[model samples]
Target: MKLTSKGRYAVMALVDLARFDNINPVSLRDISLRQGISLDYLEQIFSKLKKNEIVKSIRGTQGGYVLNKNPNDIKLTNIFNAVDEKVKTVQCRKESKKGCNGKATKCITHNLWDELETHINTFFENKSLKDLLNNNKETRV
Candidate 1:
């Protein structure tokens, strides 16, 4: 189960925003340059973010984006959900009767993969932008 660039880039961009947005709103162009992500892509990601109310857009010469809530209050899971990102380890849906191998029963590893997905999602649920920023500061020091 690999995460797509959409999920990873959204996290990276938000981390960058959390780092500098306290000074002023952060522009996607600036985040794009620093994160080496395309501006167009950031715009797309931010559109979803804005719609989800995770961020608010500003207007004018210094117009940009800012977090709608505190960094500590914004969990990674929230960002992933806002961007329609899913952490799926199994090919089949959990509620579906079908198996991952398209057989009568689930594959031997299906339970293992499902458990792993739960762990991964729980980790993200427990992590917030503040945790990431604090971890960065600790590593730098």
Candidate 2:
């Protein structure tokens, strides 16, 4: 399964948020400049983030966005869901009863794909923004 730019960008943006959380209410413009993401794209992404309660917005010239929860409490899966990014390894929608073959019967490889999806979700669920920060620290050192 390949992670699309949406998922990657959401994670990157959140990582940026976590990095500057001490400063609180980080502006999208600042994140755009630092991360090289487009301001328009960030607005769309932040809209979803805010709706999911992953982020909170502040008003005023000094206002921007801030994490609603601790970085350690925010998992990759949460970010992914916030952006409507599904961890799909197969063409078929797992939520549907029909299979990839356009039949009601399950595909022979359905179980395989389903298991892989579970593993992927589990990996992301176990990882938090804090993990990303710690890993970055190790790499920099």
**Candidate 1 structure quality by residue, lDDT tens digits, 101-120:** 67888898888987999999
TM-score of each: 0.88, 0.90
RMSD of each: 1.8, 1.8
Worst 10 residues of 1 by lDDT: 93-102
Best by TM-score: 2
Question: Model 2, range 29-97, lDDT digits (tens) per residue?
Answer: 999999999999999999999999999999889899999999999999999999989876778786777
What is the lDDT of every predicted structure here? 0.91, 0.90
Model 1: residues >4 Å from true position, as ranges? none
In model 2, the runs with Cα more than 4 Å from the true position are 91-100
